[model samples]
Target: MTTVAAELWDGPASEPVLTTVRVPVPCVARPGTTLWHLDGPCRCFVGGPPPEFAPSTARG
Candidate 1:
């Protein structure tokens, strides 16, 4: 999996924080990253922005 450069901007302006991270690239609608939850690991995300990908129609 290709490592993806990412960041998380959270909180107010004065306390705005960004989490710079490297995650495996995700599928068109499924990112290759997951959140470690107390009740086992999870990968289902809704709002995380997806990366750019070359669609099949665009691929040679």
Candidate 2:
């Protein structure tokens, strides 16, 4: 699992909410494997995809 920072926006009028979330990391070239690829837009947010994301340095 990998942690990342997601900036979610409810709407144009509302400010973006920054939060941390854990997503599954894909294996090395595994066939029929599925994982949350963080290279693009994030679908985990309720409102919509996050406009920005980055790797989190915080440790558990």
What does candidate 1 score in Cα RMSD to the true structure? 10.3
- Among the numbered candidates, top TM-score falls to 1
Local accuracy of candidate 1 as per-residue lDDT tens digits, 9-48? 9778889888766544344344453322222222345554
- Mind giving the per-residue lDDT tens digits that candidate 2 earns over 1-60? 334555555545565555455444343233244433454334444443433323566899
The residue ranges of model 1 lying beyond 4 angstroms of the native Cα positions read 25-60
lDDT value, candidate 1, whole model = 0.45
C-alpha TM-scores of all predictions: 0.29, 0.20
Candidate 1, TM-score vs. the true structure?
A: 0.29
Stretch of 10 with least lDDT, candidate 1? 33-42
Error of 2 at 15 (Å): 6.5
Q: What number of clashing residue pairs does each candidate have, in the order they appear?
A: 1, 0
lDDT of each: 0.45, 0.44
